[model samples]
Target: MTATPRPSESGLPIEPVYGPDALDGWDPDEKLGEPGSYPFTRGVYPSMYTGRPWTMRQYAGFGTAVESNARYKQLIANGTMGLSVAFDLPTQMGHDSDAPIAHGEVGKVGVAIDSIDDMRVLFDGIPLDQVSTSMTINAPGALLLLLYQLVGEEQGVPAEKLTGTIQNDVLKEYIARGTYIFPPKPSLRLIADIFKYCKAEIPKWNTISISGYHMAEAGASPAQEIAFTLADGIEYVRTAVAAGMDVDDFAPRLSFFFVARTTILEEVAKFRAARRIWARVMREEFGAENPKSLMLRFHTQTAGVQLTAQQPEVNLVRVAVQGLAAVLGGTQSLHTNSFDEAIALPTDKSARLALRTQQVLAYETDVTATVDPFAGSYVVEKMTDDVEAAALELMAKVEEMGGAVDAIERGFQKGEIERSAYRIAQETDSGERVVVGVNRYTIDVEEPYEPLRVDPAIEAQQAARLAELRADRDQAAVDAALAALKKAAEGADNVLHPMRDALKARATVGEVCNALREVWGTYVPTDAF
Candidate 1:
């Protein structure tokens, strides 16, 4: 007899052969009506990629604004459809590049932006109205968005005309990522304020990219990633409605971020199921009337965690497969990870290769010719239902714990993810899971690879920039604006309006965040939450 088929990544057993009987009781009218319609199980858009390929947004930035600006220009020249900014640790954590906590980490992970001066340089020659930008930032997302708006206004572009997204989901920070700034209560308030501010000012902008990408990188199973992410999305919607905003008003602007792994089938199923869940939740639970509010439009990034330092060049193949999975899953936009990422920051050549991978998929493959190519396939449809049920069970548990915030405070999500991570690690070590070049297809004395590295001197250069900014700006204006910001944060006023004034006065990001911290305090994780 043949050996039993292995389980999928979400721990669902894969049947050796999937026939029509696999979906015997499935109802096409109820489960999936049509592409771009209710539930959105097939795809969010009717034409899907047949109309046009998804935006090939390449995420890049490191060292300083000047360096990152050069890279952005290069990416645009090389056919990147959109820009995705990656901020350094300091900027992500609401600290200036020169802060003591920011010491050596100044510009190591991503680009350093301390104030509007840097923000202006980051988009120096780039036209804000023409290009779509997605900033991978949270906590201080408001600060960066304000800075971009100021730059756009200076370039004669109105806030209404600017289009882009900010990864403003801070709840995920409490669940997986450690870049949190304020405590949960105040953090939720800030997010609600952002939703209202964007609706009134930057109506075209996606206010928050409620993300599960980080959780997946941190080793969450596909089901856990979708479940925890949707839970966070629901929490954000509730907070906005509680803050006196209509569900349809802010919900339409909401977007999501997920990771695409090399497991193509499971990844596709995960995305389809996630859209159905979000749509049902919006209509049934939240009473969202707008169709846009029900659509789970998302941006997908290929799995960086899956890339290996051993035989790093092989990551190119892995990335291609992952990107294909995302495209097949019908992502609205995608970011393909550079092959060289596991070693260090991607070299310019590797970054171009990542974008080219998407181009090849879009033009050279027939996957873009149809909407939901896997629809009606026995295996895919069955797996989609299985993943959907598994995710709903997890979401129900989250609701039982009084929603995402309550579950986070109880460390429920984090604990579950860690256990999943541990299992993966154990499987890999036991050779039960094959990771090519690491456990299988091993090679001794791998070829020498020189990865791109940040200049340590860049930190000192940023410190100098901060010093010059301080000496040139009017201290009184900054102090006054920051005081107003503090007053707004302490009370019921929208913090972004006054916060914008502070940045307009050339106030440093760290300074504005510090002012808020004094009023709101910071988050300290106690045991995994």
Candidate 2:
């Protein structure tokens, strides 16, 4: 006798086998449209990997600007096509390194950037015109983007030549990440301003990478990830339209970020379902005519929360599986987490190994030769339909509650994700769910491995650098620019213009944020549980 089959992470029933019967009424042409066409379920580009492999962007940032800059240069030398930056907690929260709250945390999680000086050093030898950069920032995304533009200008690179993305999805922060500064109202306004600013100034730049990665890390199922993320995308579109922007003007540049787990089949289905749903929404609901506006382009990062600390080396296999899932799911860019990530910052050796994993996938594997390899597979099509239905149901609930922002204020998304996370924990504790090195193939005693440790002295060094900047810079100019920023924030003007001027005048990240914090108070979440 065989045991009962377990359900998938999204609670979809898994059968012993799948055949043509699984897709009884599925139409290949309608559901699985050709790549780069409307309802882009197969892949975004028609040629997919046939033309070129996905951008290998390993997320790397640690210590001071000088330290992180070296890592980037090394990555470029190793044939990395794009750069993804990870900012420290202080920088993410819009605080300077010298702030009281940012003392011990400086340069611990990622790199510390206090001002334009730090930004310049961060991209020292990197040619802004030649490389694409992605900054994993949220609350202060506009500020960071402005700093990058300033750096590019100093390097003689035109703003129009700068191409990259800023993770400007602050709604997810209120739900999961907790890097949010101002309340939802001001946050949405900032995002709208970014859409407008980037559309006019940096035409090639991706305005916002509306992200579901954080929600997944917080324990959302694949279905929940798609539903909430797409709902957020809807809210952003509505906000931009209300802000007097055309759908085609900014929608083409809007991108998404997701997490790829070891569940290969389900992940591929999730990506397909997400694309189909988004295309329908853009075409039928919003009436967008531009093909690019309807495309659901996204970046995928391997699930960091799934990495095991017990047997660190086993994480390499985990990352490889996760990376493969992302590729199969048709991600535009990918960042493979290092094996040592669960313990601490990745060492140079471990980081290289992580990049090598992508190299092997792009070069050695036959997975890239075909577009949407799982297109006609019975199980995949059925899974895609199932995921889409589940996600649409969740999205309907969100719509009934007004939209993503309203649902977020009521803690709907957060509550649902927390419940799913609790279920996962319960399953793991009961041994119903097996994690290779963590629960099932457990080792009694793990091998000792040295992980990368950030230097605590870097905090003091960053503080000293800030002090030097303050001493040498023109305080009056910084004050005037900040006052202009405050005026713009209080009024209807695009705050990024003055914010850029403020950073150009040597204003610290904390100062710029505090100026806005004064105008629009910080967010304080209400307990829903």
Candidate 3:
């Protein structure tokens, strides 16, 4: 290893070091107030992790429903606290495995969930009531959530008792991930319906996980990611409120998902700033009276972008550092990236090791004993303030463009993200960013590590199952459910109720979506460039 070059000091930057004097203008007692207090900058919970360590949720799902179910049980036995399900591109975009557009992608990246039958097999022997689940679905989130509700009913789990999060943030899908199915206004209307439905039926469930992970992965700065994500959350609240839902009812169930990147201190401060900003928005801006409404509970995943394709083992260290930053910043749950993630989905061994990393942190490190350990540190505090101010400024710009939806529609958000992404890529290409095995200390030859490979047989098996599902269920019932669902979409009824009924009648994801498409029509994105 050679000595690293000194980082640029000419730019306006935080001082290298500071003492008590660094907080001269800042009130330590007011800012660092107790955890679980009003304006919870320290944490949403007073005991922090002393009462319970953050839920260790490793995102896992691949191949067929049976395969994903077995893996979920395996993770639980290995001490995972929650199950985070990842769906294949087909399911994510509202196509069934057998759909023509889904041909080559079924069961490749994540689990293939087509109908209620697949949902049943996915939760086979696993009780939905006892274990919390998180689904990473966006455009077709309502369909998936309906399937989940049906699965819970099948397992004798009442709707009110079901607990979990659904990443139903379709607006971000359009701006960042490109998984949208409808235009912005209709998409937002569907989300409002879900918010209203969940508040009335599923009290413990999170209707939407306003996510910033995709934004970070799309090359937004930490400040932009935090700001834009919270801004979206506020927009959702406004949408729901405009639909006649109370802020306290839906707000408490709203949660956030963020990425913890390799910028250790920046990531930590970003989380802290996120909490403070969200709390203020809920109370001061939204006029929420409930403390839970102000609590910015979130699930953190280690930055997948930080993982390197070369010498992927280095990702283990990167993920560990990012995971630790998430814990220190007071995340309620975390997903550590597997060492082999850069190359592909993790092999079983690598995934287990990633889960173990969180276990070691919880048991070996005494860091959990103290809440917000760096809350008052000059560097952390200053960074938090800097990020909060910068994010608010960016948000004001977004507001001037008529808020997040308008910014996204005009391609402003995507353009900003592209600019940041290009700058970072330029830095990496110029060797200014040292990505260990990739840029610096380049390993000329690398040993190959086993990666998770999806078998072509899995797709065949899934298609067969889809055929069997169609054969076993009554076609009349399926047709009726779809008709009802379409009618609901065309009317003022909440779509989740009709969708859940359709799932119970064994309607496939594709069927439910197609029916709604008849009423709502499809979205055609204007040239964003």
What lDDT score belongs to each candidate, Candidate 1 first? 0.94, 0.93, 0.85
Query: Which is superior by lDDT, 2 or 3?
Result: 2
Candidate 2 lDDT tens digits, 90-207: 9999999989999789998899999999999999999999999999999999999999999999999999999999999999998899999999999999999999899889999998
Q: What TM-score do all the candidates reach, one by one?
A: 0.98, 0.98, 0.95
Residue pairs that clash (backbone atoms under 3 angstroms), model 2: none
Candidate 1: list runs displaced more than 4 Å: 1-3
CA lDDT, candidate 2, residue 206: 90
Q: For candidate 1, lDDT tens digit of each residue in 74-113?
A: 8788666488899999999999888999999988989999
Candidate 2 local Cα displacement, residue 131, angstroms: 1.1
- Could you tell me the lDDT of residue 296 within candidate 1? 98
Model 3 spans > 4 angstroms off: 1-12, 527-529
Clashes of each: 0, 0, 0
Which ranges of candidate 2 are over 4 A from the true structure? 1-5
By summed lDDT, the worst window of 10 consecutive residues in model 1 runs over: 74-83
Instruction: Specify the poorest-scoring 10-residue window by lDDT in model 2.
Output: 1-10
